[model samples]
Every structure is written in structure tokens, then in C-alpha cells.
Target: MSSSFQANLDEDYIPQNILLTGGAGFIGSHVAILLAKKYPHYNIVVYDKLDYCSCLDNLDEISRLKNFKFVKGDISSPDLVSYVMAEEHIDTIMHFAAQTHVDNSFGNSFNFTQSNIMGTHVLLEAAKCHRGMRRFIHVSTDEVYGEGETFETEAMNEEHVLEPTNPYAATKAGAEFLVKSYHRSFKLPCVITRGNNVYGPHQFPEKLIPKFTNQLLRGRPVTLHGDGSNTRNFLYVEDVARAFEVILHKAKPGMILNIGGANEVSNLEVAKKLITILGKEDQMDELISFVPDRKFNDLRYTINSGKLHQLGWKEEMSWEEGLKTTVEWFTKYSGRFGNIEDALVAHPRIGFAPGSSVSNEH
Candidate 1:
């Protein structure tokens, strides 16, 4: 498939049954809804494990759509995956279900390996067996590139070497290799997408943006890790979803693409901006504190999405605009966020060990 054809899929030119593995999660849910709304004729099935981070509420708007279907299952369950693929006549598989939290991965590296790496193997096997399956798009992250000096220079491209610093990123990088190997050795049609830090509505409070928003709204201090110098490129969830849509139709077998907002910000700067946006500038001094950083924390991650851009796609949202909108949404839905006490209790920063336990507070 050429990028031109993929770009036109939005017009319902190439109709195919699509399977979204983590359709109930933040980015997946948004992508599912976009497909349902734009290509109403195509079948859109959501296969999710309904993990704590995934909420059905995220799919509330599209659940009633005629072309939408929801299946509660784990990607690691080959039997379930095979059953769904056969029954749904799935042609394209969007693999997004995995243990995503870096901090959580530290504490339980086994879970990360099982879900991110092993689960992908199961999915690849199923895709290979399914008769009509044409493409498998593996959603990945920029962290796979690990710490680098290129963050401030040209964005890291597909040619960058894989050096995942955390268990979560390592698992994702492993999954990418598996996909590439399957495509090369077995001739499985697959494309890998490395996206930047995504934030927006429906995101679990464990992530940085949402967590900080929730804490500030509740008058709690937002913890900053290691002097807040670590920088990350933030992309809105919707933009990331759109990139998937673009790649699903356009990318050829064995292709890898990078997607990012092209905007980078440090943790300290982000916290200060959020505090100002929320009109709590006076509390900034007390609300932000630098704690020990994660183990082997990658000081920077930035992706050069020139490949995707050359394919005729670019991020449509800016961080400043995206952040304000995100803050507004979290504030509007403050009631739904509930309390962060449990999240804090479940994963504490005590012992100050990096790479020891994956922090739920992304």
C-alpha cells in the first residue's frame, strides 16, 4: 500500500475489517471512534483486557455505532485472538494492548515481558494463520531509542539504534524486533510506529499530565522526578490516533514510522506551565518537588517523524494548545478522576531505586 492510498482510506476508499487490540484504552479508544465515524462501512472490533488503565467509558460515544464491536479478551490468549480473528474476518490488526507503565515494568519486569513481548508473538502467529489478514500495525514508543543527545538536534529517525533504558521500553523494543523478524523471515505484513509521550482526555491519572492535573485540582503537590530536567516530546492522543489511521492504510510491509508533536518540554517547565494555567501559580513553590529519578532514566526522547511526514502526515496539535485543552477536560471531569491515594499507595517512591519498580505515576 502506498502512503497516498492510506491517506485516502479516510474517505472509505479501501474498506477492510479492522481489529483494535486495546480499543478501550486512551489512544486506542480515540482511534476506534475515528474509524467508526469516518469509515462507517468498515468493521471496527475492539479487543481489550479491560485493565485498570482501560475504561469502557472512553468508548461510550462509539459503542453504539453500527460498525463497532467490543470483545473482552487478552492478547496473550492465542485461542481468544484466533477466535476473534476468524469470526471478525479481520484484515488489519492494530496491536496496542501491552503493559505500558514504565514504573510498573520496573517492579514486575515479568509482566512487561509477558504482555509486551510474548503477547505480540501470539498476535503475530494469529495474523500469520488468518487467511485474509494483510497488515499488523504495532504501536510503540520513542523510549525505545533510550537517552540521547539528538533530542535537541534533528529528531531521531528510524535509523536510530534501539537502546531501551527501562523494562517497559525494553519490552516494546523487543516487540518491535519480533514484528520486524516476522515480516522479514515469515513474510508477515507488518509496520511499526514509534510515538512520543501521548497525553489528552481519557488518559489514566497515572500519566504525568493527567496526574499533575488531578493533584493540582485537589490541592495536592505534584512530585517532580530528578530535578525535572528530563525532557519528553508530548503528542496529543487524538493526533497519535490519526497517525495510526494514516499508517494503517498507507504503509507497506516491514515499514517503520515515527510520530511525534515536534514539541519538547522538561518536567519542571511543564509543571510550572500547568500551575500557571490552573491559576495556582502562588502554590507552585509548594506544589512541585524534585524526587529521585527512575532507574536508568532516559534524560531525553525525541523522534524525527520525517518518514511519516514524507509519507504526507504530520502532527496537527501543538503542546501549548493541547495542554490547555487537556487541563480543561480534566478539570471538567474532576469528579470522575476520584482520588490518587490508591495509585500512590499501590506504587510508592520509597527506597529511591531507579529501574527497580515501574512507577504508576508516569
Candidate 2:
């Protein structure tokens, strides 16, 4: 066990039982594994609907741990959520489940609303009823802040206005409001963390880093939306997982913290770097092509993690090293790449179809 794991156990801060929604997915699975290994005395119960985006193989490493348990249930299912909360003696709720893809949200806003907004409502209600629960951590994305002319320089403080551009971001913003409402009205002890792009091992290949890396490895053309000049700060998955752990363990209640990487890079640059690292430079210029940009794609997304850093938490991974590790992981799991491409096709960029309004709440 790592020192962090031992410290969590020693501090007696381990919530006898933790309820992690979407625990079977990428980031959630990594977080669950860390929590389970560190505090073997605590029971960690994962509740997930196992949607098409989620793969059970992500949790294979932690499945055998005596401290880890999984419940196949959606957060939208009131009865199922309530039952699991009570049965698991869950005192800490880590809400990570949601429809996270922005492109998918373009044509299917309803599904995004259902899963991200309505689903979050279900979880908040259950937490309200679970009088035994102590902490509720709402994992959100920085997209809720919308795109700006320049990168967010001051680090998006909790007071940042909600300006979600895409359907996925809009629903996430709505969910964050609900969490705050619960904290204020229901007196729910909730903390929210808005993290930037997360990339690392076990990440579904549909994401840019994994998707492009897999394509390069397989000798396929890597598609770049727009001119691929959009800048985004990428946080390594393990760093993201650690950010949650730090926030849950040390941060104060009712605070929203921005967790981001130290470096920001453009999409085209990221693609070129990946190809270079893979020694596939010959295919770099030829394979990389800019497709039509997604509807309402943010131009630049950079977050300041000064607040998280002030709380003694800092991102430890560099973009270069992180990308290298991500490439290695995706190469090892190349078999799963086919499934990712199929998943990507399901959400074609229909680009602001009827009913998607430009003037709307974030």
C-alpha cells in the first residue's frame, strides 16, 4: 500500500463506506482502486448503469479486493440508488456519473439532460435522505464556464458564472446548481471540483488523447476538429484522481475548486507530439486532418489551480510525460480501439440542430 493509502486509514477519515457513482468508468475506476487499496477497512461500493461508455474491464483490477463492491444501477433509478445507499452504509458520496461527451450532446441533448441533470437530481435526493452520509463530492467539468477570448487566467474561482456552451456542459452546469442548492437548502455537505481534460491509462479510447494515439498506432488517419488550434489544458488521469482524493480529504465544504494541469497545448500540437513520440512522424502531416469543428466547441480552456494548490494539492504530471504514458497504455489495450471508433460514430457532429439555442443558460 502507498503512504497516501496508509495515511487515509491512519487518520480514520475513511468513510466506513463510500458510494462512487460511475465507478466502473475511466476516472471513477482509478479513484475507486486508490481508495480501496488505501483503506482496506472501509467498504467501497460502486454504483453504475454500465452505459455503452462504461466498460467493466476498467474495474477488473479492483474487483477482487475484499473492500470493493459494485452495484449495477443508474443514478436516475431512485429505488436502486436509495437501496444501495442504505445497504452499503455509505457515508461518502462521490458523484462522477454522467454523459460527458460534448459532441454526443449536440444531436442528443435530451439524453445528456436526462443523465447529467436528472440523474444528478436523483443522486442529490438520495443523499438528502441518507442522514448518515457525511460528504458529497460533485465531480464536474471546466466546460461549465464556457469559452473565453483568452485562457482563464485567474483560475476559475467558485464564483465563476455558469456559461456552458454545449448540451453536455449545460446539463453539467444545471447539476452543479442543484448540488449547491442541496448544500444551502438541505444542508448537504457537498464540495464540487471542476477538472480540465483528464487523460491516462484505462481512459476510454473515444477521448482525444487515446483516440488519436490509438489511430496512430494502428496506422489510421487522426481527425482533428476545426483547424485544431483550440487550446486545452490536459490533466493526467492519476493526477485528476488524486485531486479528488485531496479535495475529499482536506478541502472545506461548499467550495468549488479548479483542478488543471500546469501546461496547456493546442490540439494540433498534441497530435504532432504523439506521432513524434511514436516514431510515426512520416504519417503525422498526412494522417492528421481537421474535420468540421463540433457545435459550440470552446476555443481555449485553461484553468488556474491556485486554490487547489493552496490547499496543498498540485498537479505532478507534465504534458509530455503524461502523453507518453497514455500512448503506452493505449498501445497495450489496442484491442479496445475498435469499440471506441464505433462509439464515436454514434455521435456525429450535427452542429446545432433545431432546438439547440445559442442564447441559453450555461
Candidate 3:
């Protein structure tokens, strides 16, 4: 918006050295591996605090690549982030590090605020001061838009107002405010993307899909919040990774796009589907247990992803294919994070300090 703009929107964005925060986590790791392997000439630096939900094993595919490097640190640490920026000569930043569990956020809203809002501020400040910074791609969630009316008719777009319904979503909205301010004031090139629920391999079982699959695999009751009428558009993790890859090269500065998915399913439907996929359809009635809902559970979250589709990114994984692959992966590798019994429960109100992570989790 100003003459001091750091990037030229007219030209293709070229990132020689990139920083991917939370790159060891589920979705972030997929993006990290894809970028590291796809862009051989680009240096991919992963900076993460290795929180309870993340594992270094997620990045094994790219660990041996010469262009890939890993750094363990918190984004809220100004000194460490600055050090990495200087050492890596980072020109682009894809911010994905944040405390993302809604249930956990209820018990630990302060941690969510610190990691999602304050930590994002620290990265924004670092990017602003770095002269080589060309672009800042912020990875956000569809929850920021709160609950949508319906997938068939009431899908929200990038222009919709943000009304986050939970502590986790609220903190994400707070971070978006800071990103927008940096873009308008300092002209630090920034683009934001709000993505749907992601399900695939390596996802911690705290979320719905993987959690249900694992519960069924272990012969435990699949837990559902409330009557299970809540609906969410599910995108396979790799499809989401491809969306980022598209945005990384094609998105213009100051643009905000919604990466919605076509596979919209209700919580009840998902639980039943997982049961059938896991060969427990006979016990579907007994395996699914309704639990108390969250402090506030949005009924549905549907967003219009036409903008991202226009950028050459579209959902490729069918629901049948994605769900089957996810169930199979966890059936064999359910111990990826060791015993995940804690994460299989309906609601785990995890308690952790602001800007700090716990050593143990589900």
C-alpha cells in the first residue's frame, strides 16, 4: 500500500530461502516435505518448538535433503527468530506455528493467545525488519469465520467478516489483524489463507477423523460432541499442501483466499463412516458415544474456495479415498506419537503455560 513495499506484485514470487513455522506438525510437515522436495534450489528451513502435538518424524522425508534444515525454537522468542532470519537469509515466511486445539484452548486460552497472537506479532516484526523478506504467507483456519449457515447455499468468502467462535479461533483472528496491519502500514508483502478441516496421515488424534478412526481400531467407543450435527468441509492434508504450494508462487500481496473442500460431512456421518471403514459397522450403534459439546460448538463451517481455485489449486482427494488411506495409516502406525490414549478421549482440557509447551500429550 506504500512506496516502501517489499515485494513487486507484478512479478512471480521467488523464494530462495523460506521459513516454515510449525513445519513438524501434521499439515505443516506435509507442506514442508512437498516444498523441500519440489523446489530443489530453494532452501527450506523449519522452525518449531516441538509442541505436544508435533513430532520430528513427520519431517523424515525431507530431513536428508541438503536444502532442508530444522531449528527447534519458539516463534515468540524474538532473539531466536531474528537469529534464524539472519543465518538462513530467509526471504519468505509461512507462519503455521500456533496452539490449535479448540478443546485445549478452552482450558488454556492464554496459551492460545500467546502462541497465536503474540507469537505471530513477533514473526511479523522480524519479517518487517528483514530487508530480504519478500512474502509472508499466513496459514489460518476456517474456524476464524465462525459457523457458516450451510455448505449448499451459505458459504462465506474472503470478504466475510471474522467472528471466531472459540478461544483458538479468536486467537487466530487476532493474529490476522496484526498481519493485515503490517501489510497496510509497513507494506510487508502478506497473503492469508483460511483452510478447512484436514485429515490424512500423521495427524494427532485430538481432531475428529483420526480420533474416531483410532478409537474404533482400539475397540474403544468413538466419542462425538453433542448430537453430532456439526458439519465441516474436509480436505486431505496433501491437497491443502498443494494449495499452499500454489499460493506460495501465485498469490499476490495483500490477498486473502479461502481453501475450502468439497467433502463436507457431519460429525455423525464421519463417525459412522469411520466405523464402516474400520470394519466395525456391526458395532456402530455401540461404538459411538455422545459426549458433552464444547463451551461453544459451531454447527458448520463452509467457505467459498473459488479464489484459490482460480489460482490453480483445487481439491483432488475424494472422501472415500482419503478416509480409507487415513484409517489404514493409523491402524498400522497408531503409535506414531507413542500411546495416544489421552488424545482419544472426547474432551481433553490440556493445561499449559503461555508460550510454553508440555512434554506429554495424547
Candidate 4:
């Protein structure tokens, strides 16, 4: 399996051995569990650097499964990445390793580029060397598409151009270009996916949803940026997992698909909904605070997921149901990450560039 792809794999392509980089993170962990449980015959190897936000505990469900294996390594290392591919006899790779936090990217732009852009390069190069590689699924974010109106139709399909405004988005876009180049030049059988915000159980509590839920549970005020008018399309992590499953099964090489949700809610609307669900109506005034906005926050990120839907992928969880379940889970397993007081702050990111003390508190 360490050689190039078989000539006749279009009609019937089944993944026998798969590698999931950053497989211990939120979305990746869910995908790992689903694939391992549904396809017991497929070998699932999770490669992660165990970033502060990523926890091995997230993979507890499938850790003991015969088909599931864990490997500790960094995607930036070409030797280690190549070794894992060769050892596992990996044929398909779902590259999910990247610096995802937008806020953190402002302060730690170099790390993002190193991980999101350079790390992807290592994987692509490794896949190229191992001709047995079948599929290279690159996970990207909707923010690469920049702002969209709440009412704007996301039916543009795959023709929309990338207009990343922030450091994180830019790095993701750069990674996509590498993926595209590899696919066109080497016929690497790459599949790219840009997805909206995802929230659910076992989240790191740094994003809006989990952060707010954690703060509210602790009887602390939740901070909002600007006037809280920024709108984001949110998909439950489980639903997002289903989209990956469909993509792995049906998508072809050189294809780019968008994974978004119908529930387009604004920042203010999300906070209000959480307050209502948590019975904090009377404390709304005291529990909600406004902070400065990001240097260049995208107002919206709506993308046409019709292509993914055509592949028989549809969101099955209601927004309210997902939110309530998320809140309840946080309540039950409070302090899951332990001492996340800093992570639950207004802006926990610090500028890592030379001579900089703090990043913008947006």
C-alpha cells in the first residue's frame, strides 16, 4: 500500500487503511469515532500533536477498538508523517491538523502558517511519495470565503472565490492552494471541504458556543465582540461528522465541497438563545458584556452546501436541540479541560510576535 493508487478505483473505491491527522480534536474525534464504529474493517490511525485544545480523552470511545490506533507526532515533520503513512499502510488521509482559533491567529500568526500551511505541505509531500495514497481530504473553514449577508443565497456552489481577511483564514486558504497544486500536478486525488462553525460536546470551550456555555454555567458574564451583529452558520458536530462520512464515501479527487448549516444565527442571537435556555433572562443585563471587535471580523460566512447535500448529506440536528444538549453536557462535565479560566476570558490570546505583549482584545 506504500505505492501509487490502483488504476481502476473509480467504480469501487473502499478505504482499507486511513490516517486522520489531528484526529483527537473536536470535529476530527467525532469523525474518528463514526468511521471506526461504522466501518469496523477499516484501520483508523489518529495522528495528533496533542495541542492544548486537543485532548486524547476525546477519543476514549474508540481507543480500545481493534481498528483504531493512536500515534503522537507533528504534521510539520516530514519524516514522522512519512513513517506513519508507511507503517500504517495508509491509503486515504483526512488532513485536519491546523491552528484553528481565529483569535489566536492574530497573536500567533506564525504558528498558524507553520501548522496550517507548512504542515499541509509535509502531508501532501508524504502522500506524493507514497503512491498507494488514494484520497487526500483537506479540511478547511468557511471563513476563507469572507463575509456573506444573512439573507444572501449560498447557492453559488463551488465557484465562489476565496477572500480570507484574517490571519487564520489566510493560512487556511494558503493550504488549499497547496492541495490544489498537488492535485493538478500529481493527480493526488485531493478533496477539499470548507465548513461553517461547528459546536457540540467535548469542544475546547474557546469558541463562542462552548465558551459562553462554560461562563454562564459558572455564573459569569459572557463577553461579545462589537455590537454582536456578526452572523455565522453553525452545524452540530455530529452533523458535521456525517458530512465527512459522506465525503469520504462519495467525493472524487480534485473536488471541493462546502459544509454549512441552515441555522444562520447572529452572535447576539446565539447569546440570547443561550441565556434563555439557561434560565438567565433576569441576569441578561449583568451576564452579557461587549468587547472590542477583531481587527477584521467577517460579518458572515454562508456557503452553498448543495453539492454535499446532493451526496445525500443533510443536517439532522435542530439548532435548539444541539445548543441545549451542548449546554447540558458542559454542566454535567464542568471544567472538562481543567483551569480554563483564561480560555473563558474576554480575549485570552496573546501576541507571540517579537516585542508584543498582548494581542487585540477583540
Q: Tell me the number of clashing residue pairs for each predicted model.
A: 12, 1, 0, 4
lDDT of 2: 0.77
Candidate 1 residue-wise lDDT, 178-256, digit = tens: 9988888888888888888889988877778887888788787887878888888788888887887778766776778
For model 2, how does the per-residue alpha-carbon lDDT over 1-362 read when each residue is reduced to its tens digit? 00011123234234788998888777888889888987798788988877665667888888999999988887888998898898888899988888776776777789778788888899899999987989898888889988766654555655678788877888989998899899999889888888888888876666788778877777877788889889888888888888777877776566778887776789899889988999988766797877887767788766767777766678888888888988887778777524555534323545522221111111
* TM-score per candidate, chains pooled: 0.91, 0.90, 0.94, 0.93
At residue 54, candidate 2 shows an lDDT of 67
Error of 1 at 310 (Å): 1.6
Q: lDDT score, residue 206, model 1? A: 72
lDDT of 4: 0.83
Q: lDDT per model, in order?
A: 0.78, 0.77, 0.84, 0.83
* Model 4 alpha-carbon miss at residue 56, Å: 1.0
Off by over 4 Å in 4: 1-12, 149-156, 351-362
lDDT of 3 by residue, 85-184 (tens): 9999999999888888788888878888888889999999999998899999888888898887654557888888899988889988899999999999
Top-lDDT candidate index: 3
Residue 278 displacement (Å), model 1: 0.7
